[model samples]
Target: MAAKPRVATCSLTGCFGCHMSLLDIDERIIDLIGLVDFDKSPIDDIKSFTGPVDVGIIEGGVSNDENVEVLRSFREHCGVLVAVGECALTGGVPSMRNLVPLKECLEEAYLKGPTLVGGAIPNDPEIPLLLDRVYPCHEVVRIDYMLPGCPPSADVLWTALAALLKGEEPKLGYELIKYD
Candidate 1:
């Protein structure tokens, strides 16, 4: 028997909707589990990569120094790196902040917001610093594939994963692909 392919997944700057969509694949995930082993994913509650993986699926945009480091590490450790969802492919809604200056964005949240009493923009060494603009994962690393959607449908994810695991390109039908 062949060794099962190992897949790792991570989320950066978006809602975890992409991961939710993955779970929507339902019982098909059992078939996937039989073919591939999961590593370094929120699904397994693993926070760090334990070994090199055959595939890396990254969700969300790069909006902070930490995201860049994580993405780069994924690139280094995975044979194939896939950007999942609009955030990871094109920065999605988080890119809206690109139209505004970072300083003003921070001020609106910490100092000028009506809900705050004594909130201050945190600049602690322990906290990850925000980047000037949200960027797609590919802008930071060489992504081998991109699955685009607000949250890519479960069929789209499964098809892509299955194809890639078999060393073939994913072929998506019109219904499986979405721009919105």
Candidate 2:
């Protein structure tokens, strides 16, 4: 039997709704597992890539140094890199920070927020440095495809993955493309 294509996925700086939508495929997940092998994906609890992957699915936008590092690694190791959901395509809700200066945003969250009990802005080697603005995945690296939706419906994800697994371009129908 031929080896199944391998897929890897990661979430960067947005809400994890996209990953949740992947799970929403429900029992079809069994079929997906039969078609593809997961590598370096939270779906499989694999923290690092074992080898080159056929596809790399990325959720969320690039907002920090670590996100950039991971995204670049994905580009280097995956044959096809797909940016899924609004965040990866256009920075989504997190991009709102682009309007406000990063400094003020940090101050509000760590020092002056109403709920905070007074804390210093974090500055540690362990914490990844924030970018001046959030960026869509494509802005940081070459993306082979993009699925635009707040959390692209499960059907959309299934269609895209199925097409890619079969070595064809995904042709999403009007009903499958949604921005909400």
Candidate 3:
């Protein structure tokens, strides 16, 4: 028998709704498991790549140094890199900060927020350095495919994954495109 394709996934600066949509595939996940081996994905809580992957599904935009690191690693380790959801495609809701200066944004969140009694802007080395602005995945790296949605519907994700595993392009119809 032929070896099943290997897949990996990661989420960056978005709400992680895309990953939720993947889980919404429910019982179909068993079929997917039989067709591909997952590597470096939250689905299996694998933190690092074990080997090269045939496909890498990434959700969310790049917003910080850590996100950049992970995204570069994904590109280096996977044959095809797919950007999933509005965030990965266009920076989504987080791009709202693009209208404001990063310094002001950080101050508001860390020092001047309404919900704070006494808080200071974080300066620890452990916190990843924030980028000046959020950036879509394609802006930072070559993306083989893109799925646009706040969270692409489970059916859309399933269809895309199925097609990619079969070495075919995902042909999403109008009905499968959904914002909610």
On lDDT, the leading prediction is: 2
* CA lDDT of each prediction against the hidden true structure: 0.93, 0.94, 0.93
The global Cα lDDT (0 to 1) of model 2 is 0.94
What is the C-alpha lDDT profile of model 3 across 119-142, one tens digit per residue? 899989999999999999999999
Write the residue-wise lDDT of candidate 1 on 6-79 in tens digits. Answer: 99999999899999999999999999889999999999988888899999999999999999999999999999
Tens digits of lDDT, candidate 2, 26-124: 999999998989999888799999999999999999999999999999999999999999999999999999999999999989999888885899999
Q: After superposition, how far is residue 85 of candidate 3 from its true place, in Å?
A: 0.3
Error of model 3, residue 103, in angstroms: 0.5
Q: Give the poorly placed runs of model 2, Cα more than 4 Å off.
A: none
Task: Point out the higher-scoring one by lDDT: 2 or 3.
Answer: 2
Looking at model 1, residue 5 earns an lDDT score of 91
Residue ranges of candidate 1 with Cα displaced over 4 Å: none
Flag regions of model 3 displaced more than 4 Å.
Answer: none
Name the better of 1 and 2 by lDDT.
2
Quote each prediction's TM-score: 0.97, 0.97, 0.95
TM-score-superior candidate, 2 or 3: 2
